[model samples]
Target: MPVSSENKNGPYKPQPIKKVSTTTVVNPGFFAYTNLTGCQPYYCAEQVHLINNITVTALTIIIRVQKTSAATYHGVANNFWTGYINSNHTDNGSQIIYTFVLDPTQTVVASTTWYVEAQMDLYGTSQVTSADTYTVSVTGGGITNSYSGHF
Candidate 1:
């Protein structure tokens, strides 16, 4: 179902649109992410975000999750893909990338909203959740930038 943006920090801001094609435009201007808190502490428990895409061309999004600490599973679960891993070897801190293609034929409208989420879990017998610094970069055809958050 189409949803609205619920990212606390705001939509991922494009540092400089110059890097991407001049025709590109970013919506919401904030990157949505969740830093693991005591309330929702879980390993690889990705956070959810409703991406609001308002543009002329279809949007292609790439979500990258970066973990600085050792973790059993670290990846991004988003609207485009689930449990995506770039490397076969996964453990103790990593960078996972996931992609989503919004074609013009799809029900997702150009000026509508969509959902995207991400999370990472550590290997342990018990739930050891803490605010770990992670950077999420959303890259598209003519748009690209990163946001720093915790999870």
Candidate 2:
């Protein structure tokens, strides 16, 4: 038997429609470095900006160190640090972008910043040495994050 049209208890009911809007933001990336002796300490810092999108709530910053010089005695070690910036709203993974730190530890002090120096020579022919520092600051609207690196 067919149900009466006056029945208020319908199996299928329609719901109200909803509307949504979206916008995208872009960020900038940069890098810088200095030369020094093997034993000397060095320090450098730079400011980076992180742009947030609707999907990402935070941005992760990763710092990596590479030996641009082939001095054999100068190899990079202990080269990784992590920091983050927040987006105004939640966002997908793709919305997050990374800005690397040049030096996070502040290990390289003034005058002592050297490219190469002689060691006690306990194990190998020579020991390689390097140092780095890093810091993160957010502008407009975002979370605060920071990390350091030494190598």
Question: In model 1, which runs have C-alpha deviations exceeding 4 angstroms?
Answer: 1-41, 44-57, 72-93, 103-107, 124-151
Point to the candidate with the largest lDDT.
1
**Highest-TM-score candidate:** 1
> Global lDDT of each model?
0.40, 0.23
Each candidate structure's TM-score, on Cα atoms with residue i matched to residue i, is 0.42, 0.18
Candidate 1 global lDDT: 0.40
In candidate 2, residue 146 scores what lDDT? 32
CA lDDT, candidate 2, residue 16: 16
Model 2 ranges with Cα > 4 A deviation: 1-41, 53-55, 69-151
Q: After superposition, how far is residue 3 of candidate 1 from its true place, in Å?
A: 6.4
The residue-by-residue lDDT of candidate 1 on 31-102, one tens digit each, is 344422222233654443434343323444444545443444444444443322222223333555445444
